[model samples]
Target: MMHQPMKHNRPPMMKRIADASEPYLYSAPALILIVAVMLVPLVVGISYAFRDIQLLNPFSGGFVGLDHFRALGQDQAFYGALRNTLWWTGASVFLQFTFGLILALLLDKPFYGRGLVQALVFLPWAVPSFLAGLNWAWLFNPVIGPLPHWFYALGLMDEPHNILSDPHLAMWGPIAANVWWGIPFFAITLLAALQAIPRDLYEAASIDGAGPVQRFWSITLPFLAPTIAITVLLRTVWISNFADLIVVMTNGGPADRTQIVASYIFTQAFKRLDFGYASAIALVLLALLLVYSMLIVLLRQTMLNKG
Candidate 1:
């Protein structure tokens, strides 16, 4: 009777192989979709940079290597746009992140109507970028909006003149609009990261006689560092590529003072119908962004290693 115990047989090798491949088979459709939707377009865009692809010309599909880049190298507007892009990206990110961090800290504290306050603060982010740009443009107009009058009242201007028409001051209009629209994104991300920090750690620090500033530096900042770094990187790239507000508000106008690289690309593509040139500029921008991202990642890795 003891020797009569039956043994179970293992599944065939083919069956095991099929089971192992089942997860990949299930995910294949999504992977294919991503490649079709994102990767194919990117590859096509890169190809366009090397070929003449004017939107209106039916016979403009001829390959012209490096001609667009050569032309771009001599374009003064492109150079100006590059400088404007630096100023635009830097100012927008700094102001947005600064105000966002402040707002997140304020929201972290429990208070009456906290939820309502958060919703209101985040409302601007939901507005369409073009509409936000138009709204800010109106605000700068002296005839219809209050900002100009407010500025004049504050003695910052001789009259309620529109700053968007002033080449020196025009960049600020889009930058200001961008900051207002982008702050909520940073605040939402930072607030979530802040809330995820363990309460016990803060309590322990307090129990050990750590001051508020010290606790923030030691506990809060360290926990938020990774989040802040990633968020800043993503926002930097996004804002650099964002042309909607600038195009809608300034149209790269007032002598192209507010024109950034993204807007410049748009001008070449749509206004001039030079898709090849636009794609060339876009490729250069893509290269710069990749280099910038790689540097940031390497720096972060080095800091992590040292820590």
Candidate 2:
């Protein structure tokens, strides 16, 4: 019988080890950075949530268990902030997405000076949140800003009054500013998704006697569904945690009318110098956001499966 040639079933042990270790070696730096930057602070903050960590007190870092949480449970201001957060997040996300989608659709069509228009449209997003807040705050100022006067002229207001100072309308000011600043994010993402869609699909729909609305509903929207879901999810989480515009514009003023959970956390940590309470609030907010995110992801997965 002919002697069978010896077969090599695997690479050398050292080679296999090197191959297995290569990916980890390449990823080690990023893992280390994440741990150092994100994970370390996260662990520390979680620990602080269970302790007394006032910055002004020399001996404040003592373990306090769930006292902070118990206090939070009874804090009516926190409850108010939660309600305001819902309104702020809901209105901001809705208006931003609606206007952004419209802007994206308009820009997707060929037009004169499309580049200039796109640049101008996306300009707000590039502006620092602090600057944007200041600008919007100025605009809402009856003394310096033209918006109040314009509204008065339009009969939307009885007089050219500063809406930012009105507790009933103060939240709207921040929400409006946030919508203006955030719309571009949705627009850019949606525009990219629109461009990625196959041209033939729209053409085919047109050839099948579909009208503009029909084509949009049947072709454009289905393709955009996933992008919309993701962008909305991200924007919701971000806007919930966002405090810059609110802080700069109203400082959660006029009776804490504009105070969201994020601004409340800022107040606790910086203004009150109560790091432990702030950490506890932050931890709760983090948990709530995680839950919201998981629900959205599950919903998206269900939709994708059905589709």
Best by lDDT: 2
What root-mean-square deviation over C-alphas does model 1 reach?
4.7
Give the TM-score of each candidate.
0.92, 0.92
Pairs that collide, model 2: none
Could you tell me the lDDT of residue 188 within candidate 2? 99
Model 1 / residue 74 / CA error / Å: 0.6
Candidate 1 accuracy as TM-score = 0.92
The parts of candidate 1 lying over 4 Å away from their true place are 1-30
lDDT of each: 0.94, 0.95
lDDT of 1 by residue, 1-307 (tens): 1244436466668867897899999999999999999889999999999999999999998999999899999999999999999999999999999999999999999999999999999999999999999999999999998999999999999999999999989999999999999999999999999999999999999999999999999999999999999999999999999999999999998999999999999999999999999999999999999999999999889978988
Residue ranges of candidate 2 with Cα displaced over 4 Å: 1-28
Q: Quote the positional error of residue 161 for candidate 2 in Å.
A: 1.1
**For residues 277-307, what per-residue lDDT tens digits would candidate 2 score against the true structure?**
9999999999999999999999999999999
